[model samples]
Target: MTTFDNLLLDLDTASGILTITLNRPTKLNALNSATISDIHGAMQQALDDEQVRGIIMTGSGEKAFVAGADIAELAGLNEISGRRFAEQGQDAFALIEESTKPVIAAVNGFALGGGAELAMACHLRVASENARFGQPEVNLGLIPGYGGTQRLAQLVGKGKALEMMLTGDPIKADEALRLGLVNHVVPQAELLGFCQLLLMRILSKAPLAVGLVIDCVNAFYDPERHGYQTEANSFSRCCGSDDFREGTSAFLDKRPAAFTGN
Candidate 1:
């Protein structure tokens, strides 16, 4: 549970869960160059760590999961580097969304602009009652550069998604839940506990099977419609993972089986 310069990657082997916390709480967990680099490094670390069965992403303080990208970082970039910024971010977000294991966003408070986009990049999201979500970049004479316009509409429908982006207005947790923007909402005090509980539930199932579900769903959006091909590959890959063997063995024995993200 060592802290990186810009982020905190905590591992709780007792629960087989890794929690990635966005630091810079004083900046409202704003994403800056160093912070983004730290995130990319941390996510890659999690993906390569075998003991980590599931993951939770959150912010350092109660005030925000991440309010937005750091304006300071954005201000100095030239057009070419700016384009690379979007590309790098897309790659990081894609890795989070496409990881073999489940990644959950435990959004505690404000999740705006790139913050909201970050949550969308996770496999799923659970929010605190105090959470506020929006893609207000449009208000700043900009639009969402990190998959917001696309993923938002995919989740809540084109009309609803457009309204939010067009007006730069935010939705609270209850409304987000109603609109299917978030999976669940609970009090801020219980946010981390609830995330742990959700992962515990996930841990009860077969890891390969869970990975298959995630892969299949994401495949549907793949441009090549190679989604089905992707699904087949994933299904086959899981068949050989150690967790699959343990799962079947446990079923036959009628006992809980251990998983190691194999």
Candidate 2:
């Protein structure tokens, strides 16, 4: 396990699930430079570990999953520096979005600005009934700089995404689900458990095929690649894997498939 100053990494050895908690309750788990760096480092560590099959991200306190980016840090940005700052955060989040292992955001409370962006980067989101989400950068005389503008529009429609960004207003958990921004909305206490169960269900499948599904889905939104071609290629690759053989053979034998992620 890797130690991080602004994040807590907990690995469930039996389930191979890694839960990463943002540890800045004082600032409502705000994304400061150090916190962003810690997130990048922790994600890298998880990606490299064979035992880590999935990830769950949440904040330390019940008050917030993450309120926003650290405004004090945002205040120092000039044009050139602002671009670089945006790029830095984007790169860290892109790592999350591109990971082969599924990542779920267990949003407990407020997820605003950069926090909202972080949640959107995950493969799935399970929000608590108390959760609130928004891209309120407009209130600070800025726009979402951490892939929020793009992902938000992709998740929700352009009209609703624009309404939220322009108004700088937050929406509750149920509204988020209706907008397709979250997968499930449960009681605050059930958020983590629900996410863990969801991940465990996904992890039970063939690992190689699971990863290919993520790749194929992402390729749908990527401009540089064709979605159908990517899916076809991934399917062909899976056909050659040992897991694929075991899966088919197990189905014929009418027993549970014990996948080794080959």
Q: Which candidate is the best by lDDT?
A: 2
For residues 1-262, write the lDDT of model 2, one tens digit per residue.
8799999999999999999999999999999888999999999999999999999999999999999999999999999999988998999999999999999999989999999999999999999999999999999999999999999999998999999999999999999999999999999988888999999999999999999999999999999999999999999999999999999999999999999999
Q: Estimate each model's TM-score.
A: 0.91, 0.99
Whole-model lDDT for model 2 versus the true structure?
Answer: 0.96
Per-residue lDDT tens digits for candidate 1, residues 11-106, read 898877999999888999998767777878888888788778889999989999999999888778787988888878887888888897899999
By TM-score, the best candidate is 2
* Candidate 1 TM-score, true structure as reference: 0.91
| Per-residue lDDT of 108 in model 2 | 86
